[model samples]
Target: MWLPNKNEKKKSIASIANDFIGDGEAIFCDSSTTCMHLVPYLIKKQNLIIITNGLHIATSLSERSDAKIYICGGHIYNSSGSVLGSSASEFISNFRADIAFISCEGISKNGIYMSNDEQAQIKEKIITQARETILLCDSSKVNKESYYKLCGYNNIDTIITDKKPEKNSFLVNTDIELLYPVE
Candidate 1:
């Protein structure tokens, strides 16, 4: 079997996510490099209501689709170009999305995790408010652990990654639907 490289993997993950999205749907996208890759695919959709904390995601989506980009107001993390804080979490709670696309620093037997506590708080809120939660974690982040645990594997509706995890991977033990590129 052939496996994609880093950049190819990210695009593959983004492509899988695009399959779940459709015209005129509302979605919540977190500020992760994986989610950033999703911007180009989003541009092809019509009347998409994209609510995001990613400064770049919002900017890229705005250039083509003007009306529906909702950027949350909060403290912007310069390193990652993400807006995260109490304000951001509060803002996210106001809208109900058909899906919440998110990524995290790591995933392990315990649960999903984020290095930043603020991001974790917002993600927890995102999981509850959205109809479905799609976690976009690359192969590298799988089987790893981070500081703040976001939620258990059961909390996620589906997981899209560049490759299928090893047979013993904790991800495979869960009931969550796992998706990856077949080629």
Candidate 2:
């Protein structure tokens, strides 16, 4: 499992969410704190609903009267600070989101990667139910592989990062739009 440098990770996630999401649309995001930060900015309208499993995120958004927050309940991984289980998967499967914003521990030339099987399963459901799936990751995660494969590069609609890869990098062939943060 690859752990990205904390600072770069947030910039990468923010750039990705800002580039892909549009105004007034619902988005499903991961429980990662870095990914959650994108919510306040990406959501342009007061009516935008945020779906997530992160308690911190739910609590923060609860104070925002403009947004409606839905919590996905299930088994909790205390170490990872995230939730995953059959119930969470079922809830995600029923949700039809305009975009599902996700964060992974690593990525390879092949595709998005995860360190846990249960998390991967939940992500799979989120991807299938949403119209578009965007990944928020830093460049340090590039070319790294993990135990569970979430999807290939082609499966990702867009990737947001702090830096751009080489022109011939593996992601180029997959045609996943790469967005870098504005300096």
- The candidate that achieves the highest TM-score relative to the unseen native structure: 1
Candidate RMSDs in Å, in order, are 4.1, 3.7
Q: Write the per-residue lDDT of candidate 1 for residues 81-136, one digit (tens) a residue.
A: 78989999899989999999999999888999888898888888888889999999
Tens-digit lDDT track for model 2 on 29-88? 888756766755644555777788766666666765377778798988885557889998
Scored by CA lDDT, what does every candidate get? 0.87, 0.75
Residue 85's C-alpha lDDT in candidate 1?
A: 91
Segments of candidate 1 deviating more than 4 angstroms: 1-6
For candidate 1, the TM-score is: 0.93
Clashing pairs in model 2, backbone N/Cα/C closer than 3 A: none
Off by over 4 Å in 2: 1-8, 42-44
Taking the candidates one at a time, how many backbone clashes does each contain? 0, 0
